[model samples]
Target: MAATALAGVALVGALVAVALGTYGRSHTPTGRPLALVIGFTDMAPMKAWLATAGVLLGLAQVLSAAWMWGRLPIRREAPHWLGQAHRWCGSLAFVLTLPVAYHCLWSLGFGTDSPRTVLHSVFGCAFYGVFASKMLALRTKRLPGWLLPAAGGLLFALLVGAWATASLWYFTQPGVPLK
Candidate 1:
């Protein structure tokens, strides 16, 4: 049963990756960033802020997950509320990426013009694929204990990499506008 579940997850993740990558590669980039009015002047600033928030939340997810799994430095057991907090944080963090992802897919498309963009695109696709697998893993019964933590770790790493390649790069640019 565990093997079947794992196989199913792999297939779904692969299909998602292929579909996203194919569409992104075939779609023409608009060359205009999607302007979102989330308390920022333009899309880039808004995305930067969103990605930063997502990263912080992702970090929280990692910490909470570690505590839940008894992998934390301290020996205390995770409280009952901690599980709910972890789930909420994970959901919120995923939600925060939706706009940024929409903008990327709708406006920017898949980019290969630069090394950074290529890396970012790859990370983005991998992130979603892993996210799907993790969601499925959550629903599967009698799975190995290490699966969820591993998936969560991979998702967090991919998110961080994507964030660094895009948001971090944008912020480090010369004369970047805050608004």
Candidate 2:
């Protein structure tokens, strides 16, 4: 069962990558810059904030899963609230990715101008695909016990990959004033 779930995730991710890659790239501006960021007049800060939040929430999901699975340092089983925290964090992280993804797909589309850009585009597509698989695993009972964590871990890795390739790259640019 776990093997089946893993195969499903891989297939979904591959399909997403192929579909996004085949889509024509659009360089047109989105014209939907977020307003009011304490000294910024553009959407960059908002994008940065959302990406950061999503990454942090992804980290929280990983930690909570560790606790829930008895992989943490603690000897006792995780409390019930840990599960709730994991679910809420995962949901919020997924939600936060929506606007960023919308802007990326709507405004920039997928690109391969650079290694970072290519990585960002590929992982951006995979992130949603893995996320869907994770949510499905969460809802389905017939999947093996290991499948859920595997899906969740894949989602987290994809999120990290996307965030690092884009957000981290943006922040590291010289004289690009974060705020």
Candidate 3:
């Protein structure tokens, strides 16, 4: 089951990678996000690196989620392999996430300018940190209890908040009128 879960994640990741790679290479104007497109193309090496990393990390995370959902009952039977897959996914996810997060925050204006940027940055960091802690806890056999829930809550809340900011961008009251 765990193998199936990992395989599923790998497949999804591969699919997503193909998409990301194509977009990353081309930077077509897909209306969903100019930022993602521009980000993938503008920086050359970094952008390409990030695009690949994004797919890999995404696969790791997806596999972990699928595995946990017990979608692959065989994975449950092989606890060691399951644990390994989860750990590998989590570790790789953390590493790959940094680049993408940094790309969003630093390369894009999502870090300083946009209202949504704040939530995106803060929550992203929190999510990564919490994920790291989870990895550590699992490895050491001592989870600090509050970390996982807090991380999950923060990630979701921040996502909603960021979405709100994006949705409300046009309606926000002007601080200073145009000259």
Candidate 4:
């Protein structure tokens, strides 16, 4: 139950990050912040579509993580089908993230000299790397092994670190930087 709850929390965190990433967030960057740019700047039709995509992908990830926590009776035995759906959705989410990630790279001016921004870029790239590797493992029918689990573990850790830093800078700023 603890793991399930943590996964749920992570889900909520991901959703919040998606929201803040939207345009016209009304949140300004100050001090050594974690994110270089907020998502909602343009707030036009296209950006709004991207924002919607992000929200959907966030929901998908949350669901996938929840599955990993064993909340569903998908099975500890003879449960490969449901697990495949989760993997499929996760892969779809990866595809959705590409445009958003590219936008972020553009937003950051393609890694000029910002440490936090570069960290965000590195995390995003690594995050996608793990996702792809996990998918490859699943495709090769080599899942349920150490490699897949390790990839997931690393992804979760990166998720936590990135979202935590973003949260600290986004919510706790109170008009100050994340120190």
Candidate 5:
């Protein structure tokens, strides 16, 4: 049963990755940011800021997961609200990534001109795949205890990598409008 659950999750994740990669690679990029969630004058800074916020919330998710799993160094039992906090933070963080992803995929597509862009594209695609896997793992019954944590950690890492390649890079670039 556990193996079946694991396989189902893996299949979903792989399908998502392949579908996203195919669409991103086949679609011609507009070479401009899309008006997916327009309200800001400059989207570069806005996307970067949003990714930063998501990363911060993801960090909280990691910490809360550690506490719940008894892996925290503090050696204390997780509080009653810790699980709820983790779920809320994780949901919010995932929601925050949607607009940035929309702009990237709809406008930029899967870039390959530079190593950073290529890596970022891969990470961006993989993040959603891993997120799906993690969500499934949460609902799947009779799965190994390690599966959820592994999926979550990978999701967080991919988010960080994507943010580093895009958001962090954008923030550090000269002449970028910070407002």
Candidate 6:
């Protein structure tokens, strides 16, 4: 069953990558750049902020999942609120990614000018793919219990990679311009 679930995830991920790869590069300038994070002169700072928020929320999801699964050091059974926290944090982290994803898809499409950029683009596509798999897993019944955590862990790892490739890289460049 786990094999089948994993296969499904791989298929979904490949489809997402192909679909994203097919998008033609936009000739027009990037639209609504930082509209979601208003007042930024440049999109870099806004992207950094959103990515950072995503990382933090993703970590929250991880910790909450640990607690909910009784993997934490706590002696009691999983608390109801812990599950709610996991859901809310995961949802918000996904939401925070929207503006950045919009900008990337709308403005840049995909690029391979550099290794980092390529990794970012590929991982960006895979991130959504894994996210879809995770969502599907959440709705699925009869799958092994391990699948949810696996999906969530994969999602979190992808987000971290994406964040490191883009936001962290942006910060390392000279000036670290907010505008």
Is candidate 2 or 6 superior in TM-score?
A: 6
- Cα lDDT tens digits, model 6, 52-90, are 899999999998888877778989888767777878998
lDDT scores of the candidates, listed in order: 0.89, 0.77, 0.44, 0.48, 0.89, 0.80
lDDT of 2: 0.77
Query: Which residue pairs overlap in candidate 2's backbone?
Result: none
Preferred candidate (lDDT higher): 2 or 5: 5
Going through the candidates in the order shown, the clash numbers are 0, 0, 3, 6, 0, 0
- The residue pairs in collision within model 3 are 1-74, 1-75, 2-75
Cα displacement (Å) at residue 98, model 6? 0.8
Candidate 1, position 148, lDDT: 85
Model 2 poorest 10 in a row by lDDT: 29-38
Off by over 4 Å in 5: 36-39
Model 5 TM: 0.94
Q: What stretches of model 3 exceed 4 Å from their correct place?
A: 1-40, 44-80, 104-112, 139-179
Model 6 TM-score, 2 decimals:
0.86
Q: Using Cα atoms with residue i matched to residue i, what is each candidate's TM-score against the true structure?
A: 0.95, 0.83, 0.41, 0.48, 0.94, 0.86
- Sequence-dependent TM-score of model 1: 0.95
- Model 6 residue 137 CA deviation (Å) reads 1.3
Candidate 4 ranges beyond 4 A from true positions: 1-81, 110-114, 141-144, 165-168, 171-179
Instruction: Count clashing residue pairs in model 3.
Output: 3
